[model samples]
Target: MIAPLVSVVVPHYEAPHDLALLLTALELQTHPLDRLEVLVADDGSRDAPEPGPRPYAVRVLRQADEGFRAAAARNLGAASARGEVLCFLDADTVPEPGYVAAVVRAVTAGADLVVGRRRHADLSATAPDALRRWFGGQGPVPREFDEPTWLREAYERTADLADAGDDAYRFVISAVLSTTRRLFEDVGGFEEAFSAYGGEDWEFAHRCWLRGAEFRHVPDAVAWHDGPDFAGRTDDAQARRSRNVEGLTLARFVPGHANRGDQLVWSHPDVVVRLDDTGAAVADVVASVRSVLTGSDAGVWLRDGAALAVLEDPRVHRGEPPASVLGRARYRVDLERPVVLTGATLADLAEVAPVRVGEHLAVRRTRDLHRGGPDPAVLQVPGVTAEPAQDVDLQRRWGHEDHQRRPRFQRSLRTPFVATERPTAAP
Candidate 1:
């Protein structure tokens, strides 16, 4: 098969020596040089990089020195990239000859996001010539640094992310990441709001997962980071501060349990609840919104103007959720009428969603709703039931002892959605 053109984006600062070593490594890649292009995304280096002669096309894209804008620099490179797939590498990271080929293989094999294995080494004494000779089997291998135990264990536990779950985003490191140009644009690139070092990769990966992007770990696609991991280099106090900032920044975009605190209002909510005016009492609508908010880190949208006016909380929206909210939200609950549910019941329902109770529907996984392929598993909860708004007593129901009873429902049902496909460049 003809190889798809791949653009390697190297986010750089002022590490000219390391950049040259990386470029040398890229030149040695087993992938066809004609099908590969390199873009050095300089995040406002002191002296702009002037790379010497190279076989493949090489370009340098620079931005103003506005703190650590690696995220913005990467987006700039991606915007200028014309290749079918985009691979991200740090300036200090040197890829093995097979790195590009292995990463591209994963993408072409149907993985939307692929993270190459990032090994570490002390390359301070190494030069570009030595690096090239090492690839030619003429020099000794560089002394290696220990890999992060946590990361190695994570890959092992998840079987190289083949059985990844919701929290798998934590393992996606940007230094050695690759994805198709289509998926990169689909996820809106990385979060440029991140002006610091970390958190951007996690936020980007989380968004990718929310959009149903498949992730894979390419262990054979190896790269050597110039030094030890950040945790090993920094002092405890400095590390703590960085971690705190990263956690806070991540909480704004990633509503996952690890990043979010109990009370903070995040930019994206975990779940979104939408309620249309079913002509039930205003009290019933209010009760419905309350239940969802109490159940999860959720934002409610009320179609009724009266309900919106009365609901004073910022989490309550006046109409349908904006594209930003809908795009990031993990689950969406559509209520035909006001339904009363306890926090425990609402939590349980979200786990096995695409469930229907009368006119109410809850999409447990919003990506499945958008993917529009085979029907998603829609299992019913044992004690959950939605009764008509008018027939149910919204106020008194909460006080009833039997309200907590396990619900018994019928077999699962399938909901079909229209499949949408984006046009791809012909090979």
Candidate 2:
């Protein structure tokens, strides 16, 4: 196979010393210099980053200084990259000579997203020439720092993410992440609304998984972070507050168990419900939506004129779900008739969908549905039907007169929502 061109994008921000060392390390990569390029995506530093002279092509792209915009900076670099594979690194992260090759090999071998092993070390005293000798095994190794036990244990338990599940996204670290350009575009790159320091990588990884991207942890592709892991940092009131904000920001986009709470309605729901108007009564549609919302963090989209009363609830929307919602949602339910199922049952059904429940209700894994592949499994559940015609007993049947009443939904309305499109390349 022909070697794919790899664009190494380093997000930098007022870290010229770190950027210089990173560039020097890139110069010694085992990957062919002719097939590699480096793009320094500067996040509005006071002085422009100078990559200096290099054997390979190196370009610098700068975005206005506007707080922490690493996500946007990465996206800008990726958008302009002219490579088939894109590798992301932080300005402070320096890779081993074989890092680029190992990462690219995995992507070329069919991993949609690859996360390299990020080790920590005190590189503050290290210089460009010292880094070269270190790679050459001729100099004293830098003092190593403690790796986050949580991350190390996670990788060990997941067998390098070979047995990764839906929540495996938490293991991806942008400082040592790589993917094909096609997969990156398919997942809409990193979310640019992340003006904070963290959570962008996790959010991007979550969307990639939801888009059916295969994930791999490449331990051989190693890089050294400039300092210890965040977990190893000294805890303070300011650090605690920052971490709290990061957790909350991540919770809005990733509906995973660790980051989310039971009562909050996040921007991206775990399930998207599309209830078609089967000429059912307004009460019936409302009941169906309520049933779905009862057990899952779900957003329901009703066909036009289905029911305006339910719209009062923030979770209910008119018309089909937008591309952004569908892209991030794990499951999608289509109902031609009103049906009720507990949240646990709904989750179980999604795992084995496309399932028909009494001919009018269907549950599907949104990723599988988007892929347009043969259904993994077809199932049928008996006895699920539309609501009864008796309108007076609707409240009694649902056990609540205010089923449509709930707390307001809160979410960031970031612009340029990603369009739902099938991945152009196979994972």
Q: Name the best candidate (by TM-score).
A: 1
lDDT of each residue in 1-427, candidate 2, tens digit only: 6678999999999998899899999999999999999999999999999888999999999999989999999998998999999999999999999999998888877898999999999999999999999999999899999888888899999998888877788899999999888889887899887888889999999888878888899999999999998766858886898889899888788774578877777768888888775687787667667667875688888786557755588888888888788888888887765665533356556566666554455677766765674643445345434333325356576567456567585444885556688869867
Residue-level error in angstroms, candidate 1, position 228: 0.6
Backbone collision tally, model 1? 4
TM-score of each: 0.87, 0.87
Question: For candidate 2, what is the lDDT?
Answer: 0.82
Candidate 2 runs further than 4 Å off:
309-311, 342-356, 370-427
Superposed by TM-score, candidate 1 places the C-alpha of residue 100 at a distance from the truth, in angstroms, of 0.6
| Per-candidate alpha-carbon RMSD to the true structure | 13.7, 12.5
The residue-by-residue lDDT of candidate 1 on 195-250, one tens digit each, is 88798998898888878888999999999999899999999999999999888888
Q: Model 2 reaches what TM-score against the true structure?
A: 0.87
lDDT of 1 at 83: 93
